[model samples]
Target: MRTAYSVETVRAAERELMDRLPDGALMRRAAAGLAATAVRMLGWVYGARVLLLVGGGDNGGDALLAGALLARRGAAVTAVLLSPDRAHPGGLAALRAAGGSAGPAAAVSGRALVADLVLDGITGIGGSGGLRPEAAELLARLEARRPGAAEPAVLAVDLPSGVDADTGEVPGAAVRATATATFGAYKPGLLVDPGRQRAGTVRLVDIGLGPHLPPQPDLLALQHSDVARLLPLPSPESDKYRRGVVGVAAGSARYPGAAVLAVGGALRGGAGAVRYAGHAAEGVVAAHPETLVSGGAPREAGRVQSWVVGPGLGTGAEAERAVAQVLEADVPVLVDADGLRFLDPGQVRARRAPTLLTPHAGEAAALLDVAREAVESERLVSVRELARRYGATVLLKGSTTLVASGGRPVRVNPTGTGWLATAGSGDVLSGLAGSLLAAGLDALDAASVGAYLHGLAARLAPEPCTAVEVAAALPSAWQQVRATAGTD
Candidate 1:
């Protein structure tokens, strides 16, 4: 798992570490790591062009010292001091003593710092909001002056300039780095969207702050091994009844394929049996012969460990009846697709069993009575709010899928791909998650693990395939996750 720490938590940890170490020791360690990465990115340090966009405080110190190191290695390093007077004294002195050029942004020749790399140390974790006018102007000139279509690679020190290290929000202009080398631990902004876009590739460089940091994290991203631990595996004595049965109430005459895809995903989700009760029984049976189909609502579907409601079942009277029946089942229930439209918040809030609501941004916005853009931009806030309001776990699906339940840190899914975006794909996810619910996982676990597998399967499947192909790929993804657990 990848854990992210808040800025306040990071600052407290850094202070503790600094108290035990000698003065200037921490900066040197950070500088060395940054310089080593820059060296690798440049390939050969000799005769390379290394430009440092230096600014105030420790971030500037790290960049300036790194520039000095590159200069000593025969690289022609130039430092464009954004804050000429406020630049780190020791760092600038070292750069000058090492035969590197240090001056205001105007003095730096941008006739194309042509080629190697540009280091952004304009701001660190402490800075907030947008970039200063002077800094922004200098960066614009630098970008415009780059030699025709072959601009130098930009590496940000810590996080990219102008990104909120804690909230992952970018209020204004921000630096877009080719890669960001963050020290100590990962920050929340580096893992989530707008900020995620600007961060590009993120590399964590340890500065020995692990021991001083808190055990819990602000955010968590699961790896293959983590997913493997959560997956259900059968024993020698296991039977169809023992593994657990998933009840799906979905599809209608108008859109029978929804039932087919839902059943397909559930079968691949390791459910012992999939009992599908809906108006599209024939279509489901034709697609997945193994499914046990019934032409009735969930109330008459006999016994089931968990229920998956919605997914192509239109917002009609019959669909409402099925949704109400599933809600009264006294077992975990997953709400998705058209079911989310007529969902009763009071009923969900009153349920003693776990309930998971899977909503795309548009659906979530309708639930909250807000704009879709609001939910998309502030996904973490929206998901948590929905979970609180409905008294259920909520999975807000988008570029960064977030799973949140009351009083728990949101689990940011790291495995999603653009290819997963297609018609009927969401229906498949609903069934897969419902199966996990029946398999005895909690609402949060089921949703997160289901999303992980759903995304991994999409990436593994052949491009431009239908939702059926993505669902079929689940077994292999599950096996691959389990098979690679030992390595992790």
Candidate 2:
């Protein structure tokens, strides 16, 4: 698993490590790593043109010192200091000694701005809101250069400038780095989007802060091995009923396709059996004859370990009654799509069994009573808030999917492509997660693993594939994840 720490926690750990080391040792370690990455990016460093966008503080120092190292290796390096007076004295001296030149941004030559590589040392984790006007203008100028071969590879010092390190929010113009060399630990901003999209390829450089950091993390991303260990594989004695049953209450007369897709997802979600109830039973049975179908509401659908409610069920009186009845069941339940519209927060909060809510940005905004734009921008905050408000786990689906529960570190889904934005994807995810819940995984694990597999399934399918193809790819995705852990 990959863990990300908050700025406050990272700072405390850095302070402790710095105290134990010699003066400037921490900076030296960071500089060495940054320089190494630059070396790999440049291939042959000799005769390479390197431009450093130096500012004040340790961020600029890392760039300057790294440039100094490159200069000594026969690269032509120039530092364009944004804060001339506040530049790191030691770094500037080192660069000059190593044959690197430094000057104010105004004095910078056009050739320098269009160098082969541009190191953006403008701001690191401490910055918030956006970039200053002067810096933004300078970046704009760099961006305006001719496309294709003339474009420079921009490498950010710690993180991309003008992005919130804690929240992943890009309030204004931010640097779009070709790659980012982040030190010590991964920040929440680097894993979540808007900031995530801005930070191109991120490389974490360990400065030995692990021992000093806290055990708890602000965010976590499950790797293949982690998911493999959590998978509920059956034993030799296991039978269909023993594995667990997942009940799905979905679809309407107007939209029966939703039920078919949901059932398809549940059938592939490693569940022993799937019991489907409500209006679309005939459609579901036609699509997947193996499914146990009932024509009545969820209450009459026989016993199930967990229930998935509200995909394609219209927001009418019948849908409301179905949702209410499912919520009344004394079993883990997943609420999604149309079910979310008819949700009673009080009823959800009062449920004895675990409840997981999957909502896209628009749905989350409606639930939170905020603008859709607000939820998209502040996904981390919005997901956490929604979970706390309803006292249920939430999976906020977007470019970067997030799963959050109270007092737990938010889990970010890392395996997804832009192609996942297609219709019915969320419905498939709802059924998959509900199946995991029935298999005895807790709400958090179910939501996280379900999303992990769902995204991976999309990636495994061919390009431009529909949501049905994504569902068809689940078994392959599951096998791949298990293979990573050397399991069958």
Candidate 3:
């Protein structure tokens, strides 16, 4: 798993490491790593022209020292100080001694400077709100001077300039880096977006802060091997009953295709049998003859290990009854789509069994009675809030799918694409996750694994594929995950 720490945690770890090391030892370690990264990016450091946006804090000091190292390698380096008087004295002296040029921010005045790479050390982890007026204008000027593929590559020092390291929030204008070389460990902002979007390709530079850090992370992202281990596997002695059955209370007279899609996703989700109960049972049976189809209400759906409710169940009283029946079941339940609309928060909060609520930004906004923009902008908070409010695992689905289970670190899904936003995708996810729940995976594992598979399938799609196609590609995605895991 790739883990992320909050700014406070990172600072504490850094302080601990610094206390044990000699004077200037930590900065030297950071500068060496930063310089090595720059050298690799520059290819031929001997003739490369490097530009540094030096700041007042350690972030700028690190970049300045890196510039000095590059100058020793015959690179033409220039340090443009945002705060001339407040710059790091040791770093400044090193740059000057190495024959690198240094000047005030005004030196960039009305001039188009060309460089092989631009290092953004304007601000770091402690920065809050947005970019300062002077820095913002300077970056704007630099951006205007260089545009498109022809522009110099930008590498941010530590956290990107103008991003909240703790929240991953880009309050205002921020530097969009070509890549970022983060020191010690990953910051929360470097993983979550809109800060994530600003940080291009993030590379962690070890400065030996691991031993001083906390045991747990603020956020976690699962890798393929982790997912492989979490997925419920059937053994030679596994029977249909032992494997478990998933009940799907989805679709209606208006949209029977939802039932078909959900059933499709569930069948491929490692479930023993898929028991579908709804008005669209006929359509579902026609699509998949193997499904145990029944008419109306979850109580009549026979025995099921888990239930996937909502998808296209509509907003009628019958729909409300269906949600009530499924919630009343003494098994794990996944609430999604139309099911999310009619759920009673009191009932959900009072449930003894696990409940997973999968909601997009719009649905989440309606539930919280906040604007859609608010939920979308603060996804990490929104997901965690939803989980806390309802006392159930909440999967806030969007650009970055997040699964938060109360006090646990929110799991940020890394394998997703814009194409996964197609219609019926969430329904497929609900069914798949529900199947995993029936197969005995916990709410978090089911949601995270289902989301990972869903995203991977979309990425593997050759072209613009529909939700059905995405579901159809699941077996291949499952095999692919297992295959990769085996190698490890």
Candidate 4:
């Protein structure tokens, strides 16, 4: 698992490490790593033209020192200081000592400076509310790509400039790095969206802060091995009932295909049996003949280990009654799509069994009584808030899917492609997670693993594939994860 610490936590860790190390040792280590990455990106550092955007903070110090290292290696490096007076004295001296050039931000305006790589050290983890106007203009002039000319690979020091390290929020104009060399540890901003999209390829540079950091992180991103360990495997004595059955209450007369897709997802989600009860039973049975189908509310369905409610279920009184009845079930329940519309915080809070709510940005906005834009901009905050409000695990689906539960690090799904934005994707995810719940995984693991597999399935399926094809690719994805853990 890849863990991310908040800025406060990271700062504490950095402070602890700095106390033990000699003066200037940590900065030197960071500069070496940054210089190494720059060397790799430039292919050959000897003749490379490197540009450094320097600010006043330690972030700029790291860039200046790194520029000095590159200069000693025969590269032509220039440090353009945004804060000329406040530049790191030690770093500026080192750059000049190594025969590198240094000048003010104004030096970049009219010059058609051609560089192989640009290092953005204008701001670091503490920066917020976007770049300063002068710095932003300098960055714009340097980064503007000419017609048919190759763009310089921009490398950000530590956290990208103008991003909220704790929240991953890009308040205003921020540097879009082609790659980021994050020192010490991964920040939440590098993994969550808006900030995540701006961050290209991310490489972690170990400055030995692991032992000083907290045992618990603010965020967790599961890897293949972690997912493999969580996946339930059948024993020799296991039977269909022992493996668990998932009950799906979804679809409506107006949209029966939702039920079919949900059932398909459930069938492939490692559950031994799938019992579906809703208005679209006939259509579900037609699509998946093995499904145990019945025309009734979820309560009338046979006992199930878990229940998935609300995909295409409408917002009318009938749908409301169905959602309410499913919530009344003793088993773990996953509420999604139309089901989320009828959610009563009081009822959800009062539930004895675990409840998982999967809502896209729009649905989450409606639930939170905020604009969809608000939820999208603050997904980490939104997911955590939703979980706290309803006392249920909330999965906020988007470019970066997040699963948040109380007192646990929010899980950011690392596996996914933009192609997952297709219709019925969430419905399939709801069923898959519900099945995992039935198979004895907790709400958090279920949602995270379900999303991981769902996204991987989409990638495995042909491009622009329908939701049905994504469902069909689940087994392959499951096998691949298992294989990664040597379980296959």
lDDT by residue for model 3 over 1-488, one digit each (tens)?
88899988999999999999999999999999999999888788997889999899999999999999999999999898999999999999999999998888887744425688999999989998889988998888777763453588999999899988877878888899999999999888888878899999998999999998888899889889999999889999999879989999999999888889999999989889999999998899998899999996899989999999999999999999999999999999999999998877888989999999999999999999899988877878888889998999999898888899988989989887888879898888988999999999999999999999989998887578789889988998898999998554
TM-score of 1: 0.96
Give the top-scoring candidate (lDDT).
2
lDDT of 1 by residue, 1-488 (tens): 98899899999999999999999899988898899889877788999988899988789999999999989999898888888989999999999988898888767665535547999999998889979898888777767853365678899999999998986778878899998989999998888876888998888889999999888888888889889999988899999988899999999999899999999889987779999999999988888999988997788777899999999989989898888888988999999989998887898999999999999999999999999988877777788899999999998898888898888777888886888889999999999999999888899999999999999999889997679989999988898899997786
**Against the hidden true structure, what lDDT does model 4 obtain?**
0.92
Q: Write down the RMSD of candidate 1 (Cα, Å).
A: 1.7
Q: Which 10 consecutive positions of candidate 3 have the poorest summed lDDT?
A: 106-115
lDDT winner between 3 and 4, please give it: 4
For model 4, how does the per-residue alpha-carbon lDDT over 1-488 read when each residue is reduced to its tens digit? 89999999999999999999999999999999999989888899888889999999999999999999999999999889999999999999999999999999876644436788999999989887899999878777766767777788899998789888988888888999999999989999999999998879998999999999999999989988999999988899999989999999999999898999999999988789999999998899889999998898788889899999999999899999999999999889999999999998999999999999999999999999999999999999999999999999999999999999998999999988988889898888888999999999999999999999999999999998789989999999999998876532
Q: Considering TM-score, which of the candidate structures 1 and 3 is the better prediction for this target?
A: 3
Range of the 10 consecutive residues with the lowest summed lDDT in candidate 4: 105-114
In candidate 4, the residue pairs with backbone N, CA or C atoms under 3 Å apart (3 or more residues apart, or in different chains) clash, namely: none
Considering only N, C-alpha and C atoms within 3 Å, which residue pairs clash in candidate 3?
none
- Clashing residue pairs in all predictions, respectively, total 0, 0, 0, 0
Give the distance in Å from residue 21's predicted Cα in candidate 3 to where it truly belongs.
0.7
Query: What tens-digit string does per-residue lDDT give for candidate 2 at 1-488?
Result: 88999999999999999999999999999999999989888788999999999889799999999999999999999999999999999999999999999999888766678788999999889988799998998898888786575787888998999989999999998999989999989999999999999889999998999999899999999999989988899999999888889999999998898898998988888789999998898889989999999999889999999999999999999899999999999999999999999877888899999999999999999999999999999999999999999999999999999999999999999998999999998889988999998888999999999999999999999998788999999999999998876531
